[model samples]
Target: MNVAAIETVPLFEYLEFEFLLEYDVFAPCDRGRTRVHEPPELFQGFLHCYYEDVYGTRPVTRELQKPLVWFSCGFDRPPSRDAVDRFLTDLEHVVDDVFDHLVE
Candidate 1:
């Protein structure tokens, strides 16, 4: 049987940080809730994972921790898996719109 293959694109090639920052969907932290990472940054990370075809907080977190990934994304260091997970959870209510916006 012949094997099929797909090409891989370099991470962040067409995905500029400024582009992700253009979307202002993330809501401000509620009175009792506190966020360790900035909303835009986390959302950018979320989108980065999407474009790179990476899924889940664990893999995303790992991908983000690559030596220069954080610096390139404007973070001093990558956020923990827990932080990524929390960011994902927090966006559950509005994530569909966010994805729709990306499509458009």
Candidate 2:
């Protein structure tokens, strides 16, 4: 995902309160059933996610416009690599998207 695109959303909306959760999508995987890997800071800012759902109408599919409240405010702590991988793996939904139109 593009970092500049992620920064377009207003971060202040998420600064002191909770953001609303909207929709989700299942993403595609590698031949070995590998999962998407994202850096900790990737989860820190406004970003879009792509999910390739092998079981859905199509593969490498995506959901968009969902919002998430990052827990990094307390500390500069990032989610463990394993946890991040797992989250990406199980991301059968979109927390948000700034690119594509989000369809349920």
TM per candidate comes to 0.62, 0.27
Give one digit per residue, the lDDT tens place, for model 2 in 1-104.
Answer: 33234332455334422212222222334455532333223333223232112232122111221222222212143334454444544443444451233232
* lDDT at position 32, candidate 1: 54
How does each model score on lDDT?
A: 0.63, 0.31
Clashes of each: 0, 13
- lDDT score at residue 6, model 2, on the 0-100 scale: 38
**Among these predicted structures, which one has the highest TM-score?**
1
After superposition, candidate 1 runs with Cα above 4 Å error = 1-33, 100-104
* Model 2 TM-score, 2 decimals: 0.27
What TM-score, to 2 decimals, does candidate 1 have?
0.62
lDDT of 2 at 26: 29
